[model samples]
Target chain A: MSDIQTDLQAPLQTPAQPSEDSGLILPRRSFLRGAGTLTLSAAAVAMLAGCESAAAGTSASAADISILNTALGAELEAIAAYQVGAESGLLQKPVLDLAVQFQGHHKEHADVLAKTVRSLGGKPVDAKKAYDFPVDKLKSQNDVLGFAAGLEKGAVSAYLGAVPLFKNRDLAKAAASILGDEAMHWAVLRNALGQNPVPVAFVS
Target chain B: MSMRPIAADAIGGGPRKGAVHRAGAALRRLYALPLAAAVMVLVIPAEAAAAPDPARGQQIYDRCLACHAVENNRVGPRHCGLAGRQAGGLPGFDYSDAMRAAGFTWNRQTLDRFLADPLGVVPGTTMTYDGIKDDQERRDLVAYLLSLKPCAPR
Candidate 1:
């Protein structure tokens, strides 16, 4: 598994800026191997592959499953958040329509995540019936929209955290796509609430 | 010529010769095998290494303009002084709780991983798009992102 730092409470520190001359240097150049070396390389690669599966296979999958569940939990939370907001009778038709559509997206995410976990031979976690959102805090349409935006933002972060951990490239991309939709939803809702739609440059 | 008896050491530590030794040599070629893989199982593919192509990164960065910007606020936060910027530290942008919670500093390694698969690395971030899968493209893209003005020192 890739060495990753995903702790949510780690103190924010100033990191070095990106540059070819400085910061993290990613090794992307392919090795120039001789054609005669093919057989030898293949043998080494094969042995290494076998050993990898035998050793870290179990722990790697467990980590992947755990991250997926975290994402899945976020999706369920978003769904619940929307459900409560939609039923609050506070949003006008336009906003309510948006909320329903956003809820649908979360549902799609939840199903996909559940399926992914099951595909990995892990049991999918069930969603909670009710989330502990601050219902009493919602006093106006702006508050409701702000709350919804917050939820979408949280979902975005959850998906982002999980994106790098997925062993499958396609699954990583899928998570990215979902993140985009959630960001879009958050921006639109923020606009509705008169908050700055775009908040930062590179999302954490 | 008389055939020599096969030796037990011939399978591995012995000199490289004979058809059987040749087969073992394939797996034993220390030069071909990655040193790290020997210790750990599968090689993580190449995690991160590349030269920056800001021009290419610039081209690809167009995809991010919908939400992100170089210095000004758009649908997302400004990219000015992004280098060395703390995760979720932008002043005015209302970052996702997940981003705000992630305590990290942007570097080639973290950025590359995230660019390869945004969600795989960060999980709850709102930035969308399938990650740049190609190693060159990813490095270039991040190099370009790195070129953006970094935040001012406090």
Candidate 2:
């Protein structure tokens, strides 16, 4: 907890410059290994793989459901990002703990949304064991920071988008609450990557 | 001779004794009535003095309502009927742990200072809105916010 707190409070350090051949930055196998503890069933993975097909057939109502699906998607992505960071053994204990805590938070959020969708007579979206991040092939702390920053940015946007869409006040408030935490996560990641923690205004 | 003496004593004592007892009771009642009246008069003013002006509080809330709505989560916490409420009592908004632990109630004086500079009063509050500078404005906003009763019967 102290380590997490320190990671949260510590000033942003500058990220090292990206190495040449950044295209090969994150390799597929290494990226999967970095994302921790994914146990998606084969059927679930197949379902997710059919998203483009499912999306093509979706109606307006399905679009609404898709918002939740998108949130779940972002969570899956974050879980993968955190697992990669945690498994790499590159981050200090404190940074790794913070990453792990956020991973748990994302998992909790994903679980709640999944239950909500199921209760609403919809199938929950499947989780992903691996994701495509460009920085997996890079060997430096800077590259990892870049990946985390991008992941946090996407999560923040997803939460913000979902907040207004929730009809239930309790759910809206809950989303807002989570949004604040996601915002903090974004700040911490940006700072870690040597960017401004508190931008003049919210970024996106 | 004994019966004759007892009868004479009872008849002579009755009217005179009853008048004296009645007069004493009347005087005691008069004293008690005034004492009770005095206590009531003293307590009423104190009660009125303690009750905040909900109207004025509404005016003070204008400064806050810009960034916050009564029920909506915006840049800051909701200010609807905040008088005498505990800090971090609202659900779902992730307040700083310092704010959660801070046991301050939102009475007039505390609110006034807080509205003036939230970070100064409660460090690490995410509210970036600068505090209201005018003392009278703060008072009015407080009055307005207090007017909004949270537990009003539906």
Candidate 3:
């Protein structure tokens, strides 16, 4: 959860200007910095029920809810990142269109996360009045794409961490399904930035 | 009032029916993966082997080292048992829907095509590695990966 704590403390890093030769993107280090971020869904509800059934008032169930709430917070933050990019007024045409589409996906992610949290007896975290996004760096379309791509990659990693955490194999599969969509979003955004869409044999 | 996932596993008969979600199982499995470092060492050797420049393959595998492991899940599933395994066949590994239904074996030819263009081969795969362009590098990397064992995670 330190990753969430870190997200609250500061905005994403400003990647350097593109290299002339390889054109690599020095992605905002903090955005997808850690590969261990969590992303659970209904484990909150189902696990809580299982724990409650097994033990009346154990802190173990609370811990499960806490993980789910944190995952929900990650989704809220992701949706906000998309909103900030979409409303920045710097995007136009295809970029604008793509932003809306990606935002829609985040909304889907948010909807599922929220519903799971609510059903599990935990309150979903609300988006802050304003997030600590790298808003100042939204100077150009490429910057916007870079920022968006960075968060998409972050979500991908977050789900990667979260998927295996699920106690329900179905929920685990669900998280992996979302991870794939997030990866798809990452690939398209990178492609638009003239970055290599598939940069490795495995995507981290 | 039960809510189900919108993205159903049409081919796999729906989200691995009765799959258990043990808490901390992944963490426990990871404890046995100290050999992951060995995979890195085993993965990339420029000329450590007088063997068939498959030694060159390990160097090319550097790009893959980010998301894959010889053991368990990272941003991608572990590559420990990749050779001859059915696509998306690893139990407990969360594979993309596209990958789960890919219905192909991970032999030399299929892996080569997927390595060349992951999106082309598995239309909706989430693998972010842009395909390896060089034919030789792809071949070599696959060879090295094939030589590896799954090293069961706990």
TM-score of each: 0.42, 0.39, 0.43
Q: What are the per-residue Cα lDDT tens digits for candidate 1 across A17-93? A: 23434323321111111111222123322332333333243443655665555566556656777887787766665
Task: Judging by DockQ against the true structure, name the best candidate.
Answer: 3
Per-residue lDDT of model 3, residues B58-150, tens digit only = 655444422443453433456676777876677665566656656656777667667665544554444533366666667787788787776
Instruction: Please identify model 3 stretches exceeding 4 Å from their true place.
Output: A1-64, B1-154
User: Per-residue error at B27 for model 3, in Å?
Assistant: 18
By DockQ, rank the candidates, best first. Answer: 3, 1, 2
Question: Can you list each candidate's DockQ?
Answer: 0.02, 0.01, 0.02
Q: Tell me the deviation in Å of residue B86 in model 1.
A: 27
Q: Per-chain TM-score of chain B, candidate 3?
A: 0.64
TM-score of chain A of each: 0.68, 0.63, 0.68
For model 1, how does the per-residue alpha-carbon lDDT over B1-154 read when each residue is reduced to its tens digit? Answer: 0000000000001112243433233323322334554466454455555567989887655445333446544334566666666656677565545455445556565566656655444444444334566778777877887787765553
Looking at model 3, residue A48 earns an lDDT score of 33
- What local lDDT does model 3 show for residue B21? 29
Question: Each model: TM-score of chain B?
Answer: 0.63, 0.55, 0.64
Higher lDDT: candidate 1 or 2? 1
Q: Which 10 consecutive residues of model 1 chain B have the lowest summed lDDT?
A: B1-10
